[model samples]
Target: MVPKGDLAAVLASLLPAPGSGGLVGADALRCARALGVDGVAVSVTVGSGLNELLWSTPGVSTQLEDLQFTLGEGPGPEVAASGTAVSVPDLVREPVDRWPVLLPEALALGIRAVFCLPLLAGSACLGTMTLQRARPGPLEEMPLADAWIVTHALTAALVQDAGQWAAFAAAEDGSDFYRAAVHQATGMISVQAGVSLAEALIRLRAHAFRHGRPLNEVAEDVVARRVHFRHDDGDGRAPLAGGGTEGP
Candidate 1:
């Protein structure tokens, strides 16, 4: 439990140093420990269609982010859209209709609880901070307060030096923030299917779902030219361009 006086200090210690600019280092793991969560992730809302992952702890944290991107559902997206924090203390008790696809998959990944906090600048939500717990329980009072403090300070820092972070993100673009192969595959599908990029992404998600495969794996196949999306192909029906079993 963080004392009132120590809260400010805690926030300062967690923030990135001036000119460090981006949130792509060990901060997420450190914050997870401090917040008593198993893992944490921060992602920026890139326009209306994409939420680019900024930094995240390895394994489940990263997988959860990718799952949300693949299915376009989850607490992170909900927080980003509504500018409100989402706390699911127990996924098993959560309504299936709320996240019909994400819930089961996340549970399969061993995530029993989750929380998403909005990074807001004025009325705009710049991004989201997601925390995952392997056990089903609500965040304790102190950790919840600390999470808000960290989120507030982080938001202020990003908003105060918006240009610097923007340049940092642009420089890292595909390599750091966005998944390179997924972005590349989306473009390929857009061209091949004569659909908008947004629609192409939908098709990609649909394909990944139909095959019961990770979106990244499917995108890698597309980028590698193992699979192709022809104009005549419907959703989840990308044919094998090189005569293969499509993808796993």
Candidate 2:
């Protein structure tokens, strides 16, 4: 059995650097792994669609969850939408089909169990924190408690960082990584498509999901002018106008 003090210690270790930003994704994933969870993923809803903040210690098919965002279905999306924690102790044994597309894909990828917790600050839902275990078994209560501690820690960190983006050096440290570009691209797509930022982001995720590609890669294409969105297409496709195909 895990001890509450041990969980508290784990959370203590997650404290963000003073005058630095929030905790890093890798750090959070590592912490979850240390607590003995199978996998951890951080997802946030930007505009209408959700984006992956981090997938900690994922399996070979880490991209599967991303597919859910693109397809607009899955445990992560459900948690984000409901602003409540959703736990599927055994994915294969679940009675109802929460995510028809994602469930089958997860089962195929050897992910037998899962737990998803919404990342929220008061009433504002920031995203979801998911844990996946390969074997089927109930999670120890202590671990669940620890998970909540971590989730609240993250929430606090996010709130702190938002008010002070420069508090963390990483926030100031800029990179051309796809995740950052994706945010920029989302803003651009929103303007170009004349759609709400959320809707534009959802469209971006749909395209990424349908094509079996990383959202970051899709965002890169958008930034490079290799891809563009057409609001006229109800199916969320890029028009073949500039050498880009019309499928996600």
Candidate 3:
């Protein structure tokens, strides 16, 4: 078990630097490892069922975020949407109905346990901090408490520093911090299908799921005119031209 004193110190030291913006990925990874989790990430909701991944540990953690964004399911999105924490001690033991698609895929990716804590600004949920473990189990009491501390600190940083962290993150490693393509495609689909932006996004996810492609790739295709959505298209599902769904 991690000592609360050590956790407190680590969190204090890693609090978002006003000059450098929010907590850096390295510091986040260090804090997550110290808390005995394999990976962790922070994200904010951009729109209905859309999130902007701010920072995350490398490897499967990053993949998990992408998967959740693509499938529009999982504890991370749940917490971001509802502003309530969602803890899955063991994915295998979880009811398939809870996340019918995300469970099998996440298990295949070696994620055994997951936890999501909301970052709240007053009564509003700004986003969430998602943690993943390779082994199946719940966090110890100390670690769980420390995780909440991390969320509170992150929330404070995001609220106080405003756009500094987001801007800094956008410049790091050429990451698409804002998920521009997803947003762009949603808008296009909204117009093409004559549907609300929320419905357009739902159609985008369904199309991605049907084609077994990543959501962003499909969005990129739509933005590139490789995929077209029409009001008459059944359920707004259309196959990519040339039997492919990737953008050129």
Number of the top-ranking candidate, with TM-score as the measure:
1
Tell me the tens digit of each residue's lDDT in model 1 across 97-209: 99999899999999999999999888999999999999999999999988888788777766775566666657744234347688899899888777888777888878887
Which portions of model 1 show Cα errors greater than 4 Å? 1-22, 166-175, 232-248
Q: What is the C-alpha lDDT of each candidate?
A: 0.79, 0.66, 0.77
Error of 3 at 7 (Å): 5.2
For 176-239, candidate 2 gives per-residue lDDT tens digits of 1226777787888877777777767777777776676777788888888778774564664344
Best by the lDDT measure: 1
Clashes of each: 0, 6, 0
Sorted on TM-score, best first, the list reads: 1, 3, 2
Q: Is candidate 2 or candidate 3 better by TM-score?
A: 3
TM-score result, candidate 2: 0.70
lDDT of 3: 0.77
Model 3 CA lDDT for position 127: 90
Off by over 4 Å in 3: 1-26, 163-176, 188-196, 221-248
Colliding pairs, model 2: 19-167, 20-167, 20-168, 21-168, 47-198, 48-198
